[model samples]
Target: MPYKLSATLSAHSADVRALSSPTNDLILSASRDSTAISWQRATDQPGFVPSNVLRPSSRYVNSITYIPPSADAPKGFVVTGSQDTIVNVFALDKAKDEPDFSLIGHTENVCALNATPNGTIVSGSWDKTAKVWKDFKLAHDLKGHQQSVWAVLAVDEDKVLTGSADKTIKLWQQHKAVHTYNGHQDAVRGLALITDIGFASCSNDSEIRVWTFGGDLVYTLSGHTSFVYSLSVLPNGDIVSGGEDRSVRIWRDGECTQTIVHPAISVWAVSTMPNGDVVSGCSDGIVRVFSTSEDRWASEADLKEYEDKVAGQALQAQQVGDIKKSDLPGPEALQIPGKKPGDVKMVKNGSIVEAHQWDSASGSWQKIGEVVDAVGQDRKQLYQGKEYDYVFDVDIQDGVPALKLPYNITENPYSAAQTFLQNNDLPLTYVDEVVRFIEKNTAGVNIGTGGNEYVDPFTGASRYQASTASTGTAPASAYMDPFTGASRYISGSGSTPSQAPSSAHMDPFTGASRYSGAASVPAPTTNILPVTQCNTFKQANVAAMQSKLHQFNEGLQNEISTSSLAMYPQEVTAIDEIFAYLGQTIATPPQQPSVTLTAAHVEAIIQVLSRWPTSQRFPVIDLSRILTGLCPRVLDAPGLKDRFFEALFKASDWSDPWSPPPPKPRETNILLLLRTLVNSFQERAGLEDGAWPTRVFESLSQAPYAVLTKTQRVALATVLFKFVFSTKPRAPRPF
Candidate 1:
């Protein structure tokens, strides 16, 4: 028989994001309310009751797991990962607010956690890395993922599996990645290990895939129509998955057997008990359990009330896909039987449109909700190619059309305002105005508790003041770039050309440009200091670069001597991820949860540049130029910046004496190297310490400025201009 609701437990005041069930009698839930609750059922009790609440973090507690009992913690420990980037462990026997052990190593939001039977814990974070903990101490740091690690599973004491927002799964043997499985087109959000098979993964692409340990994809289950966030395996080997579609689906033998819909916006997490019960945490702040045994099912009155809640929701047309109201049949269509369970059918009754779902258990169609037109009702708008919760039109001038400002509810308002200003080439001073406009328009509709304070991770700017008010009065003359802390260039005042730099220029990094008076002082005929703004070579055709890279790889594979130097499988995966990230960021409307490039990706580029033939190295060098411009944090390591630049110099023969009209390959390489250097001047591109920049300048001094081509000279000049303006005072030198 299909599963039916057995119990409903509600104590959280906010969305429940994660759930774990180690036994049939115990359940743990983590919520955005910053608390983790333990629910227990006595032998004579018919339902679970909240037994203890642990305030694990001040921010949202996103993930939770149970560790086996040890001598130190007789009743076992409750582990939690939160948005504050800390993983905390608390003993179940104690009711204190403070944790017994705090495992803090992640630098960003810790979103996933899992533990092995022997008490080894593995955690994944938005920091693009995972960590293993043993006996309350750091065991191994799992690195190499190029994006946020959203899902993690401990296969055993020595093996772990991590799924990432980069749309790939990696199997790690201790701290090293041994195998990468790539098939998902969107973020891989959930994973569950099968007994005999390798594992099953669920993704934002709305597909569940089963894979074997031999790296072969067994089959795919494709009934869910939205992002799948959590997965678990039953003792009988059936797969249970929950998703944004508000449905808990059960898969048996690679096919969807049933879908249990919830009365909430999202079913964020799901787990299976030691027996046969299923547990789910939902966005409605409720934890529900379902069982196949009729004796464990809830009372008839409670089931009816739950059904009414599901039927009361008002679903927009977009949620069910494009609805052609004219083409839909009338009420008579409900008389015909649906082919399978969970099949949705829309019918027009008189002038109203209704949504109905086929229930195999009841052998009838159940009215789930009413479908309404989605113009201004809960449906996301398509801005460029990406979907956004809101797209406002801002009229900057009387005669000009309003510019479109796209935003999502989950994004920080300051970040959205900055993106809007940058996209429209507007002045940074308008940031406050844009933010106020957004707050005024989006008031009361924002999700969660509105007054909670949040700190922007990128800029370290506070989003809300202590009085529960927006921080709109903060200075806007100097705004920091989110990725790089460099001061954004604000537009100059409308004064005469001969006027000195405006005192309104508050950014200490850029005092004033001597070239600010361009009209009064004739343009310099030679390369000079203090250019108005730094010019970066950032534009690129990512598809073309990727195609050329693969072409070169194929060429190397066909040759006898070069075959050994062909890109390694991991290197190829890294390169492909680089292009994917570039494509997403450069799209008309950039994708959310942006991928972060790691030192491993930089290492891959270095390997290709060092090993590929000279003629074939330009494409790789061009890719480096784009990577540095887009993700400068990849060079944040201790010696990675030095090594990366050294590879570029070696690839271009920068140390060799230059002759006029150099070889075509060498000339192309040098030009690309110069362009890459121009892109590397932004903040966090290893400019904190002046040693690397001095080395770069010293290398360029080897080539006489007079002998360089026009393109090379222009690139070199831009690099020098940026270095001079963006950094502290340094001795001047001629190139």
Candidate 2:
């Protein structure tokens, strides 16, 4: 009750994409229009209102997160990821317009970002890569998602869990993706982690999924008809998700058991407060607070004009001639026509429209004024030479006030095509022209698999190119081609196919090339069309079912029903309630596990060690985020996983040191055992010519992890555990 809209902050010129409250009193908001603003709630409102204003950014801020201060004193920091493919960091109290750090190198838009205990930031980009940054410099790039990355959460202090537009979530050990959850059909937008167990996520695919670090599906919660736009896991083990269907649902144990009226209105973000109230920020430029006490789901409106119809129906000797039940307090319930009985959607948005009367006597289709006792929409006649195309909806029905149409008609073929393709994995019916356009406008590309001749889309001249081959790897002369795929080239020549070489002869270094001089770029070919509509529909159903099964796999042992927790209508299962409480409680605690400064964590320390103790000003590189998780995999033998955390807990009092330490020898043995494991991994992944894993690990070990603070150490530990030990495998899609 004491909170009176502490700060009325105007976030952005457009939709606010993300917000992070790093400081208890401050909120940083990022917007779709490529901007970010810092806001503060006044500690004393009697004098000045707490208002947040914009910061400096030329592009829309896609994501913002606060990193906990590393030093003993409080440090005010805000990190933002922008569409410009840069991660910008600001120190709130420092000089105006001064960025403490500006990390770049991502080739596409940065979609998600998170801060770590070490003065480092991790970000996911549309380039299908995740990166770690420290002090305005580049870091190691993590190649994972087949599509754009959408959201990310630090697994501990070091590792990160990234959800992507590719309908998968990857667990990254620092900069290396160690595991992936490829179950959801829709792009993931939000994720919440629970200790070292794994995490939960919401996706545009209309479902919630939970996964362990090992990439195992734990459990799946369902029930949203539209895209799940926002989600928050409550401390009490319940999940609150806001969907495009215009309803906010609460889930406990993975099922939608309750719903709340929320006409969606473009929900951009959702957060669960400690007091159980859920706040949703929408595209309408307004924030709404929904609580349990007023959880009354509105009953369908009983149009008063239908009173006579209801009265007559109640009659017919029903309980002695319509007993006084007719004198109810609510509107007289009416059986609305043109809708199925007992349909919830009927009352939500349904109406009848009367057609213009054809007055034969006047030889004209004239407006007959209006029809009485009918709900209707207004429409207008549009003359199109011969017959009339509808200009707009106009109601001729007499029952009510002014008429209005629910929607307008307009050409949206591209949107329609996108929806169709997404739903059925089909290609556009006709795309030859589109291919030619890309060739003209884009970096002219010529796709080929074998070394041969290809006709240009425009010139119609034969250009030596590789033919589409069975293996994705193209000859030195071809673009990397995957196995047995139909592909399209943005060649200058109109609808012509490239030729394959009669004999296998290709220069290794020269690889593949085309006439206009473009390397064999990734193909734009997909078998979207040609499939039978009925079969495609059936396949779509199978895909959806598979997604559900995959969700079940990721959900593991936990699930939350999609219902309103404030006024839950469904019966609560005995055990689920405990987790619901824990989910909510997680909000209050700092979300990082304990850390132990081990050999692997310190491996990356060499980079900073060369600069030494007081070298706060050192060469900034991508090593920061990469080392936190990657170093452990190479330098430490025992990978970071659930077991690693348990073992680390016994050796450190960094988290909660209420109990006495473990016996001396037991602690020493575990540490030495972990050390030996690290040594073995170092040997396996060292820079020597070996497996790709070894090369990656060796490259990561060249850096040191010692400069990381205790918190950073712990974060690094968690990152390594999630990355090195997670066992989830991502499902790859054929393009």
Candidate 3:
């Protein structure tokens, strides 16, 4: 018998992203609404009801697991990982708004969580690291992944497994990576342990791979047409999976046995109960339970309503692959029998196109939905095995092949531009141009609202403004900070630093607009000075940045025209040495770097920034920012500071006419340049001659105050403040 809908639990107001079924009677679910719910099976009915609601974070709670009960928590603990980069534990017996323990370590969103029977918990994060915790304390920091760690499994008290966006699965023993299994062609999203034959992993490549612990490939399961988000194992050894394809599939021995379609855009998570029932969390904010037992199934009326809901969905043509209305058969196609249980057949019914699936248990074709051609129907296109909302052909130069600019509607435009520029070895200066291209093509489409809103706290700059239907332009006044929910600092009359909203202050150093609880410095009065010291943006993920720089170098190396732009052997060594220096300095209990930085490293950064395209120059510019702050002496030589500032201005297109609301990439570059300038105001910054500093201010004065973004204005102000403080003794007093 195939799985049938047993119960529908609906309370969350947003997408349910993760689920954990510890037993037949207990189910834990985390949702985008920032709440984790504990559902208990009713004694009088077959349905499950929300027994307790735990508010673990203000942001989305993305992953959940169960911990066995102990003396402190009699009813056990429901552990949740959230977008806030915090893992919280809530005891069932003391369910409340606050968590019992908040485990904080990962620097990015905690997206995956798993627990061992002995009460140890493992968490994977977008920070590219996994962490193990025991007894409510940090136990081990599993760090080796080159990208975000998206999937984690606690094999036992000592052994752990992690799957990463880098497309490799790692077996870890304590804090060290013992082995890495590579096969997935795309981001690995989900992992589930099999009874004996190692484990099964699913990826954005739309294929599920089974692998052994001994580093052997078992088999691959291919059926899902989109990114698989989750996987779970049933008691009977069958594997259940869910994905962006809106289906929950049951697989047995490498073959899909049944496909349970959902009435949602994505089935985000799937978990199995002790009795073999499958629980799924969906984008529709519903947690559903499916069971093969007919007695446990929903009533006939409820089942029919559910079926009608699925059948009434208007699916786009791309959702079912490239469908041609002319090639589809009429209603007679349903008359023939289907060979497999989950086989799909599309038939044209008069003016309507219906999608039907073969249901083996009922021995008939069930109408799933109606396919319709909607606006932006061509939106989900595949590029490099991953589905993106748009993949544009961008011509960088004449007579050269156009580069691919792949973007998702939900992604930050600046990020997309940087990625495109980085991947193509284009200059960072083109970031603004690319951003304009994206905005021009994607205009009039409402984005960054409802379920699709950008909710990640770390990347708040990417959040879009909610636009009005009357005008395509997103209102500047209505731009809200994604984290604080306060209006962003908009420069103009009636908006002064003191009068601005309390949470609207932007961090000039990082270009981050979120409130940091720093006491506001009073506005300068009569040049007496504000008497406050300025801070530099010094914190960074050195490893990730180094990886990206090398990746871009590899891209340049593989290309003909850009080969000259690739880093020379000594330049590469210099960059590596600088990164190594930064890694040690940024590490906890900072250690001295083995090799001290010299003029060669400074020259290396200058060389890259001067030659690389504008889009590809950010990392090098960022490196300059770090270098200026930490090793100002490197630029102390004659003409060195002048060359550095010249390179920075050219890389950021400082001479270009200032536009209100600069493109994200350009804005970022400008901000970094300003921060670097601020850092240059320190002692021994080689500013005694004042020639280069004059040039810096002269280039900056080109952009009118009205045209500068709030963050840029703040950074420029900081540069002036730092300059005055650094050279106040040398300043000639008024006669």
User: What is the number of backbone collisions in each predicted candidate, taken in the order shown?
Assistant: 0, 109, 10
Q: Ranking under TM-score, best-scoring first?
A: 1, 3, 2
Residues 365-472 of candidate 3 have per-residue lDDT tens digits of 999899865333222454543446556665433233345778665566678887877664346766655654554444444444263332222222112222222122
TM-score (C-alpha, index-matched) for candidate 2? 0.42
- Models 1 onward score TM values of 0.65, 0.42, 0.64
What lDDT does each candidate get? 0.77, 0.43, 0.77
Candidate 2 residue lDDT tens string, 1-735: 111122224434455566665433455666655556655545654112225344546665667787766443255677877757777777665445656667768876677787666666778776666777765465655663545667777666567777877777877665555666779876787888754467889887778888887878889877665567666765567777775444566676665534543322245566665555555554434344444433321112322212222222211111111223323222112232212111121011123211122222223332211112211111112121001111212211122111211111121223422333343223454222222222222222243312322221111222222222221112233312121112322232222333333221222235433223332334445557433321111012223323322222222211122111111112112112322322333334623323333443333223222222121111111122123222334233433322333333233322232233434333332333233233333323322223534433453353345432332333334334433433234453231
Q: Write the per-residue lDDT of candidate 1 for residues 610-718, one digit (tens) a residue.
A: 8987878988998988888877777889899999999999998887777776777887788889888877885437677878888888888889776676667767888
Error of 3 at 400 (Å): 9.9
For model 2, state the Cα shift of residue 161 in Å: 1.4
